[model samples]
Target: MGDPIKKIELKDGTTRYRFVIDIGRDPATGKRRQLTKTYDTKKEARAEYAKVKHQTDEGMFVGPDKTTVSAWLDTWLKSTTVDVEKATAANYADALLPVRERLGGKRLQDVTEEDVDELVSWMLTSGRKRGGKVGSGLSVRSVQLTLGRFRSSLNVAMRRRLVVRNVAQYTQIPREARRKAAAMAALRVPWSETEVRQFLASIRGHRLHAPVLLALIGMRPAEVCGLRWSAVDLDAGTLSVELTRTLVEGEVEEKGPKSEKGKRKLPLPKPLHAALRAFKARQATEAIRAGELYERSGFVLVDELGVAWKTDRFRRAIHKLMEQAKVRKVRPYDARHACLTYLATSGVPDVIVSAWAGHADLSFTKRVYIHPNVEHLRQAADQLDELLG
Candidate 1:
């Protein structure tokens, strides 16, 4: 018979390149059989061929399965982390969409390291529109964030035995350092004591003065407007900030404090305490005489009919007060800044000052309230002279 179609092999020197199938026969049945095996080298290929011959004598063979990566990735995103926030999900979809076209047809096993690298390169060089601007190149931070989300998805796939390994494990983006240099230039511009005095004097005849004073004592505008007479302790001189009201979609509604720390009870300033006490005495006298005709709405700062003060009305009141007082036109919120800046400049520790400003971190208080100026320079020089002497 022709030389039995023996195991074939291709190789270079000591390195094995490929494996071949060997055609053999089953002597018992007088039937033909096909055999296949792998090799370490061409010399070893001969040995492997003999091994295959031996295997055919027995029985053993396996083949690789082909699965496309793009198809797998689609399944991965849908199954894993789909419950992430809406904004986060949108970000993930945006990052992976363009790359899907490039990887769509390739088998999961066929996608090489080069393919992942090329996609990253393309994402960096390409222009992306974000925040009202087009033609802005992707930031390292943005690229890294998106890739991290992708890696997490792939890691889930790996756990499911969908892939042998995560190709993105070795990949990284060149991230820029978080530079807060602009904050160094930031300055606290609070209302001056004189301006505040003038404002309070101007609003004396208006029904909004008490609320304005509540704001002056460092209570947030929403807190002042939302204050209920029940929560105010005229005897103890305190205001409980349990609930605050603000305009939501153009209509006023009561909402929780912006943060848990914002729900703190602030000790009323002397001026605010005095003003509120006077307001209470006046209101009580008016209510006693008027009886049921005195519309009591449970609000501390309210209109003629005892309704909650609107933001626009509050702003207009402040503006009118400013025009009458002829003080520098600063926003009503300047009162809060005035309180914080006064504390910082007066040498109050940032840790304690931050609490009153409703800041969770002392560093934030320092950043917003502590500013360098000629006064700071003078104070430094004056204080250092004693030590130098």
Candidate 2:
């Protein structure tokens, strides 16, 4: 009754049908427009034609655009404000780089589940080229994180109506990768209290003593580096972890803690209190020697010239300190682990330990930092026996 379907015979003797529908006038040009679709059968073409005609009559027909994944991602990155932290934005950008390199050229609307699956597979097996050679494939955790970033950006495209679905949601990290990730997580080892005490004693009188002591007190490395004299009260014996210093993309940035719990005031231990007092007195003497050349940065930890320590410099110093200590070598971050482990073993309540460590959740502290020693388990069994008796 409407425009008749045009049937054509192919060279292979199969037949095909073409359907055309009057969509509407081009608003800008004030001219009539049509949508054309081809199908293998007249029935198929007619079905599609009816759907399109209904959509056109209802004024809900939206023409597909030529937007590519890369273009959409670029736009989304520029426009997105949610979940973007100053200290972590660079890491998010870095995560998106591989997505752009792999799928940027593909049309946003045309990105299929197969394409997303292929991207995940490639990330698992092949590594991004660094210099002239291809580096090792990304770790399972890295792949999972990268895919998560891609999914988040694709969600933006869906919200903008650029794509009907986010294909990335269907793709998953392979089973092998998951097993490897689990194994790696299980291998994380925290230092013992004895090792921590030995390390602190060895690093005594070192320039990094203040930072190392702060780390041993369960302050994050960033929080330790960002500590300022104004936030410390020797009389009250409290230190406030209000700000953190981070290096993102090789640039130093000072910002508040990542979560509300991170902005907490913790009691200063007696040893740490004495150390800070001595350190401040020594800094004052150095400030006088440097005179006008001394940089008046109010940071609690500073070099002899009074400049605050950067993250990289602090990492190198910690590594060297571990070697000099000749104790079981562990990362500076393990200092927090050591402190958390001691507290957990010494019968400290999970809530208090989590607050003192600035952890947003107690489960994370229990799962990661609370390594139960054999002796502690034996003591727990003894307590259970005494209770039953």
> Tens-digit lDDT track for model 2 on 188-226?
666776777788788788766777889888898899989
What is the Å distance of residue 352 in model 2 from its true position?
1.2
lDDT of 1 by residue, 11-93 (tens): 54344334556445443376765544455545666665566566445543212225576677677777754676443445576
The best candidate in terms of TM-score: 2
Error of 2 at 73 (Å): 1.0
Q: What is the lDDT for 73 in model 1?
A: 66
Give me the runs in candidate 2 sitting further than 4 Å from their true place.
4-17, 22-34, 53-63, 128-134, 384-389
Which residue pairs show backbone clashes in model 2?
none
| Residue 169 error, candidate 1, Å | 20
TM-score of 2: 0.86
Ten residues in a row with the worst lDDT in model 1? 176-185
